[model samples]
Target: MDIIEQAAKRLEELRRAGVEVAPEPQPSVGETARKVGAGSTAPADAQGVAQSRRVELDMNVLTAHGILTPDSVRSQLGDEMRVIKRPLLHNVSGKGAAPVKDANLIMVTSALPGEGKTFMAANLAISIAMELDHTVLLVDADVARPSLPEVFGFDEERGLLDVLTDPTLDLSQVLLRTNIEKLSVLPAGTPHPRATELLASEAMNHLLADMAQRYHDRIIIFDSPPLLVTTEARALAMHMGQVVLVVKAESTTHAEVRNAIAAIESCPVKMAVLNKTTGHVDGHGYGYGYGYGYGYAAKSSASAART
Candidate 1:
């Protein structure tokens, strides 16, 4: 069959299985901002401009519209989660993207919980998978609080935790495919006796190394726990080639952001993504110009939730 015919057949199969595989994400506040900026004729430095653009996603759109979450679990994650995707790609490329076969590791982290790190990771993975021809791997490295499986509505039958504890499990068995084409997932796996130890183990290192080798054109993103909550985030950060710090507006303290930045200094951090923030909040009404039409955000908040 031709490529179009094959794609149509695949879509039909997925639909028959009740898999929602629409190519577009809910319209994001950032999308409009991007469109507005795209028309500019100014020749700005790519790196400088990329750093200023925060990675943003609409979590409310996902939750209200029933879009998938990081853990694959469907829920009303009230706050909006937004993140920049290009900065992430640039960050990965800087870490020696030679050979195009070594899928660089990206750790999405936050200073505190509820700052939308997992949300950012999941959506960013989805965005990358959709935008790039390369395959994407979203790894739930946050074993202490595994959310990747629930976000995508998949169960952690065998994942990082399982693979680390038992070297016998085939990596293919744990690498689950998602509704999004070219997006595979490695869940945190079933909670083990020593989750932290497993993550820090040599076997875990080997496992990640092997996966990178196998999926050369792919990007692997890790949804890790909050840096302040546990040492796991810091430990895993060392292994990653790039770090995308998700900082919540108002909620994330300045000190916390600084500390988080300091911790990630070892790795070449891609620019940080400010998330779940509004320009103004008054009596349950939020007004924020995410450089996108604020009106669109309200409409999308309702429409994208069920999508």
Candidate 2:
């Protein structure tokens, strides 16, 4: 089964098992103010320009979903993400030998639908947002089938595309600031028939450049579409400094991964994560693997796979 099929199957299991999905969370006025820089005593060297809009996130919602928490250093998933985010963080701080242009922009994608690409993207964003020195903008660039709103339980239609299609739309207006001080979201906006063209346009290029360079301490992460399924993924990949390809264990074939990587070969840095692995000893649930690799010949083996 592809990622989407597997996800559907899991949802079915959850339904049969009577798992109670929580209702959408409601953030209080004070909570919203705190997340968007209001009611805060913290000193600011903040973004030079003043921002007028802020969208607060509910921590209860996030934690219930198994995402990183403020004290995420203790969870198993947190441990995994901390290790996964190390190199990305280094590249973000200009600590890499071959610093990539727009290195702060990271793309999370998969060879096909049904791999855990979106899961990887969301977790990575939450993980990086935990950093004291970094703020994260997780953009839902999967224009064809945006899932972030569902993932975060956010009910909104205005986001990234709204800004791109209309010059008058203020980015801050569309940007959603969460209570997680360091994390924000730019939704895919209303879907467009010309998503690929829009992504490939000069306006999109300028928007990415502005996001990357505007805030020196911010990292932009895109939850892009599956590479083989959409031209939009490649278009977004062209603008990324790093690409994390999510390869599902036992499901994604070697040839499929090669082709997906080939699709975004222009990216200076690339990493492959082996998702949904059942390899763990001593009754531990899942043991995620990590790697720093380059080129097509890096590794085609299963034993060393990590995601």
Candidate 3:
């Protein structure tokens, strides 16, 4: 059976077993768009269907927050992100050391809060979106404490959870297309009590499959919760082909990093980004930089580091 059919069957089984699915809504496209704060001037793609609502991201605000913008001049942060995204893009193109099942589905998380996972996720998405051959969808998967709306200066609307809960909600309806042609943002939707369950459900699997296969050059970055702080991140990590763990240099404890890595052990490709590392550059004054290590090399380095 196809993915959609398999997902439908599994959802039916769950419903029969007493799972609480959201009641189907019969709202028209316009009503649905208005309800989600998606404006009326929805652009149409090649298929002639209305595309996602277009939202303008403030360039000045993004610059102030150190976010990578399409038109921004090159900087240390952009250079770091380019280095960090190389292997990831290689994996996505099936050019890595080994093939990954859903290399396009990448989750960014940390061992603890305030470790810069969201920042990393955003930068990575922007960097990939700037790629000549790629498009990116940045999903705010941190349902408990989402930051994408604030970071991007966009209003919160129905998104990932909404699509998962309401079968009637199409992913395209809730997606927020940004001024940057290649970048799109998916809000964390209305918070739900059973968010962990929703993320781990069969519906999520199907949605991810659709998202990964929708465009060959599309890369989806999920800003997930801290692995050690919430069960939600672990649930989301289970299906991610690559897990990017952001570690705060001189802040996160060794044991915490170890435990966090263990939580997402099932992920095929695990990468660690050492954030906020202060060091000298070319005899220049000390400045912050990002350090990158891939797969087991990163894990081993983290294990050997002293807290």
Candidate 4:
């Protein structure tokens, strides 16, 4: 079946399963062509949303082997990282040799909708977790769109918001183990009308601060929403040690990127991940399994250099 039909069928299945599926926005013919062309040339973080004649890849198939490969995460990231943002891997892996800090938080945000911020967050978390000896926690902070539960197959009754709202709730109670050995996920709890308020609460801060201490050796990645859409992302950005912005080529105006950066300029290192990227962006394939060296690289490279 065609892309539209497949998407429709998936939505139908979701509805049959009692999950509410939002209506898929239809793009104009001109807009459709533009997205396809843009997907081909977009930067690393932005290129994953392609107009392919295929259904969403089954996460079950990927996990059937009992291990999550770098290629599996890379493929989920789509073509954008392949082209424009590939250099980011080097930048993230090449930051100066600095003293390593504990699980400093990283919040992934975008300027506007459809920039693929959550998609990048999920893949990046998995990629980071794959590094030998490293553990990673991927938090779905975007309660508005809540993709983690779907991506990792977790129930919505238990998660971050629930724990944050209930003073008696323990963080460990909400943490769910995934198929990946070192990766754990905290899905966005059932949608709440007061999501922003919940995210901004002191309880949330205490939860994260405590989580940082408990998972000191692991990386905590918050997959937040678009800054332009709500203040939630900006609020979360303040707590993070680093904010990685995913900017889509062509689709994202330069002004949008600058404004998002300017809003959170206080962040020590706000790395840009250009998605829907073109291959020439980074100037190399650096494809999966170039060497064990890639696996050994630590995020201390992402720490603020003395420079």
Best by TM-score: 3
Query: What would the TM-score be for candidate 2 when compared with the true structure?
Result: 0.74
RMSD of each: 18.6, 14.2, 6.8, 18.3
Candidate 2 residue-wise lDDT, 161-190, digit = tens? 766665545577677777777888988997
Of candidates 3 and 2, the better by lDDT: 3
Across 1-307, the per-residue lDDT of candidate 4 in tens digits comes to 4435544554454344344344546689999998777665422323243221112334564343122345554442333333322333333444523422331577888899766666567767766766675677788899888865554444565677766554434566566666566777877876666678767755566567777786766678899989888887887877776777878755799889879988777665577776554344444442221111112211110111111
Candidate 4: C-alpha RMSD to true structure equals 18.3
> What overall lDDT goes with each candidate model?
0.60, 0.71, 0.77, 0.60
Instruction: Say which prediction, candidate 1 or candidate 3, comes out ahead on lDDT.
Output: 3
Alpha-carbon runs more than 4 Å astray in model 3: 1-22, 25-50, 280-307
The local lDDT score (0 to 100) that residue 56 gets in candidate 4 is: 32
Candidate 3 lDDT over residue span 1-307, tens digit each: 6535654665674475356875554689988878668644666666444568889999876765567788877766776677789888889999998898889999999999887777788888999999999989999999888888777777888899887766545688888889987999999998888777777776777677778777546888999989987887887888888988988878899999899999999999999887765543225443433322111111111111111
Clashing pairs in 3: none
The candidate, 1 or 2, that scores higher on lDDT is 2
Clashing pairs in 2: 3-114, 4-114, 274-306, 274-307, 289-306
Best by lDDT: 3
**Candidate with better TM-score, 1 vs 2:** 2
